[model samples]
Target chain A: MADVARLAGVSHQTVSRVVNGHPNVREETVLRVRRAIEELGYHRNSTARALVTRRTNVLGVIAFDTTLFGPAQTLSGIERAAREAGYFLSMVSLDDVSPDGIVAAAEYLVQQSVEGCVAIAPQRSLVDALAALPGPHPLVAVEGGEGSGLPVVCVDQVQGAHDAVRHLLELGHTTVHHIEGDPLWLESEARVVGWRRALEEAGAPAPEPLQGDWSPRSGYALGRSLVARRAEGERVTAIFVGNDQMAIGVLRALHEAGLRVPGDVSVVGFDDVPEAEFLTPSLTTVFQDFAQVGKESLALLLGEIGTERNGSPGPSATERRVVPARLRVRGSSGPPPP
Target chain B: MADVARLAGVSHQTVSRVVNGHPNVREETVLRVRRAIEELGYHRNSTARALVTRRTNVLGVIAFDTTLFGPAQTLSGIERAAREAGYFLSMVSLDDVSPDGIVAAAEYLVQQSVEGCVAIAPQRSLVDALAALPGPHPLVAVEGGEGSGLPVVCVDQVQGAHDAVRHLLELGHTTVHHIEGDPLWLESEARVVGWRRALEEAGAPAPEPLQGDWSPRSGYALGRSLVARRAEGERVTAIFVGNDQMAIGVLRALHEAGLRVPGDVSVVGFDDVPEAEFLTPSLTTVFQDFAQVGKESLALLLGEIGTERNGSPGPSATERRVVPARLRVRGSSGPPPP
Candidate 1:
């Protein structure tokens, strides 16, 4: 840098500024510094250091931000945990959640030498691809349901859903209607299973669940349709929505239709989103510990990939870690339509 | 390669898998390979390749995913753009948005040889840390206001805020009540400035603006306080919230208080988030082109950082690129109550 500075007839600080891409440098001086750098063959030294250490201390993740509450918050948790553990986190978020896209994104990261991976985009095909490859580094699927011959870390969505439905049933609602999440997600299917089980055990008629693509728009449309169905003679009271984002839409749609929550229709949502409590009648919802899920997912992956100085074989066997979920009963759910 | 496999008594594919950290390899096979690697004194070739080429082809970004709509969407846009340009995107997302935290995060990336950096957490001190680096790479501040001495690519928050206020004014509202975003963010400050300008230009009484921490809960509290103030003889007719998330809270607070949107009070919001149009009355808000902002930020950074292959000197003059923002007048805003 000093050589470049001397050659370019500028201070060392100016040379540093030119090299760092500071926008305030004069164009002519920038050009002179570049010429000096080229002549002197100046370059930073991380590459050489990396060659010796063989460790980048970076972890790769593939996640989908689909705007639902869980994925984004979970990502933050993973980031915080990784930083604490002295590893950097980078991700290739799949634009196309298809199997092909998932596999291609993984391959891209593998080439970059990410020590290990935690995939938050949990489509079956993506899970299958991760299972088949298995090594080059460890792979753990967060929220991919039990074992598919690979390590997995998931929130107990079914347990959370069961608790939510049971809460409504305990509140004296004969049967709870449900708005299911995106069909593609395993969490959706698990929630459905939990809700149905609760209904069956209670001997209440479990109506076929309404489907929502996990958007406020879908929730609004579906919620309004449910209200219409109720008006047409079907008894609809308590609703178990897929997530709080959709629950927002449900509350809005119900509000617009002149249905007072917990008075005309009770509502329970999953994912206890930040806005859940601030809704017209605060939502009664299931809370998933997304940060815990993220932290555990990283810990599990690190267990396999091992630490920077110590590369333990890391649990070579397929493993599963289930984080707990709980239900928070707020104003939205109550005795059905007293 | 043949020698290592033969020495380890494993298939060449097995050696490759072992080297890649593929988890399915037998523990015994991994040990055998490790012995062979130690004997051969082998190291990964990517580091060697990096030293030779002087380019990692990886772009580093320090972003704060404080879970707001704009920042997250901007990140997605940046990921897409970087992938298209064949530059792998890695990020250190600061859970702590403090300036000290921001600078330390940048220093961490500098040691990794990221060709360039984008700091989405645009605090003044963070901007200063980036400006002083004057490195062998480049830096750009997305949504960092002008005269930060950094190349800036930002959505026209001022224009967007102005448009939001103007729409309400043109709708014949007496004055628009402003709900400001977090004070630390340049966007928040910019929006406040724009709101004041619009109110002053329209000759409307710019009653002291309400403040929100850019969360629904905060917005709810602030909104409820305003409603209470109005109940105590304060004349409040229209409101412009900082972001869509906060707008949702305000709408909910008003609804619970027996106020009808656009009929009892008018509302407009900034950052027209995805759920904005799906909200109860469909929010009338300022639409920031976040994807465009992301693209322009990367483009500006690349112009300063130059390509990995040519290592050409890029622009030295301070540059500011402002993407356009427009207002989407929806059902939430109408002529104020007579």
Candidate 2:
């Protein structure tokens, strides 16, 4: 510290202030001090410095541990944004959502003195747990409920699902069958609502929906059930799948049953993942910009840390950022054949 | 420190020894000190403790950023193993592999005081960078290598590729075409070797290999080239695709060319990804046990940290740990039509 202070012609206290990222330092003086530190190869040992200023420059992230399209892309986006903003992201997975288990995970980060937390809130259990805790540190939520006095960045799940269902209805299908995610997930519940709303607005009978656990095998099982019903002379000309993986399984089941896509049934899916384009018939699905959600969530957390505000313009401003999804048309969707 | 000392009925110096993870303490004394710290929720605020101990309990990882099957699976496996072993995994992606770029990516982790690093050394440039660095930290290279010295944990890429080709030969294919990854990768070079060795051992002429960038589009382009050659009266009895994504593209291409698999040309792919089973004709491919590799890597690192030894077991040990690959025979492969 003394070497740097002497080299830059600054006092030891001034050097400390510059190194600790104190906002009050003059830009020119901070620049000179940084140059000296770099020249001296003086690594600012974050552990030692954190003791005096109590800021670790570490941002804790709670994310789902899956290779599924949405969460994985969101995590990548968060890493990019967080690194650019000069924060190190330390993550814990919420693959298991028991309150005690989640609490244990959060406690581990809290013990590490994380400056702020950003929970990738995909499930209701996670949201409920975060809501229960009066977090000792600043907190933000991603894909979570708005107006908990905690900032939330979310994709417009209901709107995206509505867009997909509306696309199916516009193709002249009298009714559409739905395969929805586990009801425990907020996205799944919201998507079901969107499908029902689109059907009600069209004055069409709401067919009973098939439930899936978001795995391809689950989708295959439900698809097999649907195929059996079709074999018994029931007609389902269009199906809206909850996600791309399930849509893929449905396509395979229909193919094996001698039904040609678009000619026998039109299929629409959500989360137009990379593989959807490569599927034999191709997939017409809704594309959610998961990377955008990740980027915005990171920006929100940094905004909160710097100014103690969750990136809101004001209380009157929108507390929620709902990124919209776009519908991508491909070979799987078409007007009812003949 | 004072609170912990009072709770443990010891002086501050003893508490310091416990916090530093010194192995000199008696077992009973260590237990007493740990219990006191847990009761007080005292983790020594790693930032503060790191100043003196110089250990961060964090392992930095640099991997390719693609959502491709191999990298994604390896990352997931590493994350699982890391969390189980009480280490934090901080990852950065290298989108390109220029030597300087690889060094910069690694320097980011070095600056964070990661006690060790695991570089996914795939390309020649990355391997060169890894070799050049004067490491003050332990490094375990995973998945690729130029030369073996610094504790490498890798599956037998050449052997995996050989097994795929041998399986096709056993199924009575007189010749098999090869599709390979980018030429820059060590695995690609090794796969080429394995494929050639299989043909030479059988005294069959080496078929010309097709180039791909480990993507479905690249495979589709190469598949089209093969279809054109087939149309010119050249026969392709079988093909060994570099990965399953490319195999899917080749299967689609064959269908479009009116060539039925097995009846026209059998296909074998590497990396039996989740989607392989769901493809129109389920893919027969090579499967690497990434979980075993990940678990082994974590165990190796922990052993290095706990004791001074690297992956080489003590003198008493008779065998080295290596994760092996297996051939999964599925619907896509069969005997060539007579």
Candidate 3:
């Protein structure tokens, strides 16, 4: 930096201002400093700068199961938001969901001097673990359920499920059977709650919900069981699945049994994935705006960071931001059989 | 650190050894140092340690469009491998695929002092840009095409495509129609090459491939076009789509057009996504081992880093690692229109 300043015939402070993009620098002086920097092949060392300014301009993101559609899309949204905000991301994806592992991952980010953290904590256990973390201040949790006493940003999962079930019920289905996702996820629990609430409100009996591991195979197996139940004279007409991938399985299983979608049975799914619209019967699904969730989470975390920097008290534990979910009615859902 | 050493009644060297998990430290001394660290709330400052030792133990990953199944799975695999190797990852996902954007992302990682970098460069432009980067040595490109003079790790896209097309031809199809993915990606290009080569080998006329954006909607549109061609008395008995998502759309289009899969028209797709097996006819597709690609890329990157650290000339620019793709036969492919 000193050599560049000397070569540019400018004060060290002027060179610093030009490098840092300070607005007050004269255009010619800025040009001269940039040329000098280019000529000397001087690249700013963020590590040294972080030490001097106590700022890394790097945020930490803790994610799990990026192979899943929701988490992958959410992570992508967050990455874009972070980049737009001029902050780099230090990412840690947890293969082990143990409490110790979560804590260790957070500590690792802290060691790297991340300014703040946003954890895509979709599981109840993960939210609890993150809530228990002692420090790594200015943390925000995404898709984390309530009562953890942490700032959170998430889609309205319960409402989304309720809307889908209500749509099914309005189409003259006496009740809606749910094929819930992995029970370990808070999303599954919330969707279950919504499904049950919708059924109760409609004065209908709720059958035992089948649990799936959020895989198509599980959905196919569960769908076969439903087919068997219908064969035994059970009234199985409308089905609301936890996610689109599993819905695809259920669609196949129903087809193999010679049952027509929306003719003999109606099916609905969540997570309006890209392929959902082009499914054999075009799935009626709930759309969670993962990009909005990501943006809101980052905004909340940045606000917390600002408060911390200003020496103000942090955000309240119950502080939450909820993005709305919309139901897309498609060919797979319709009136029940006469 | 000094406070921890003083509190533990140990030399600074002993404290350092314990913190670093050196094998030579006495068990009792290690316990004492750990207790001191816990009591003092001492978190090792990696920034300072990096300054002293010039080792950040953080690797950089550059990825684009991770919402896609392949890239998302590949990233998950890399994260698992990096964690197992006890390394932290600094990740940058490029929303802009321009050469300048790629360079800026690389430069950002370099500023953060990453020990090495792994770029998921699947596009021709991306590989060219990365190959042109001045420094940030020990870089490995994943899914990057050949002839860029860079160490590359990718699944055998051409071979995978060849196998899929050959399977259809073996099923007694006179010719196979193609639905290629976005032309900008190297994977799509390789698949196109393989598809053309298979047609030439079989002495069958090669049909001009329809291009899709790797989305179910695009596939649906193109499938409808194929249906129109069939209506005009053209043979449209077989199709090989570039991806499972688009294949889903094609299936819907065919079903709507009253064409039975594997009966009137045989279909195949690449990227056997989780939903592939559960699609209406249970798609026959090529499965790319993304996890293997991730692991191989990281191993290759670590090898480059080791060589760089040892002051070696580094691996040859032509160094390449290829993970094989497998063909999974299922319900979607059979004798065409017999």
In DockQ, how does model 2 score against the reference complex? 0.42
- Candidate 1 on A68-182: residue-level lDDT in tens? 4677778878888988897877777888767777777877787777778888855666677666663336777888866577788988888899999999999899999999988
What TM-score would every model get versus the actual structure? 0.85, 0.88, 0.96
lDDT of 2 by residue, A274-310 (tens): 7677667778998999889888887777766766544
Candidate 3 lDDT (Cα, whole model)?
A: 0.91
Q: Which stretches of model 1 miss by more than 4 angstroms?
A: A1-44, A134-136, A307-315, B1-44, B134-136, B307-315
Measured by DockQ, the strongest candidate is 3
Clashing pairs in 2: A47-B47
Each model's C-alpha lDDT? 0.82, 0.78, 0.91
For every model in order, what is the iRMS? 2.9, 2.0, 1.1
Better of 2 and 3 by lDDT: 3
Model 3, residue pairs in steric clash = none
Docking class of 1: acceptable
Tens-digit lDDT track for model 3 on B1-338? 89999999998889889988899988999999999999999988777777778787889999988999999989988888887897888889888789998999998888878888899988999999998998567789998998888899999999999999999999899999999999899999999999999999999999999999899999999999999999999999999999999999999899999999989999999999988999989999999999999999999888888877778864555689988899999999999865
Quality of candidate 3 docking, DockQ: 0.80
Candidate 2, residues B42-126: lDDT per residue as tens digits?
Answer: 7666776667667687887777763556666677777778888888877777767787767876777777777777777777667
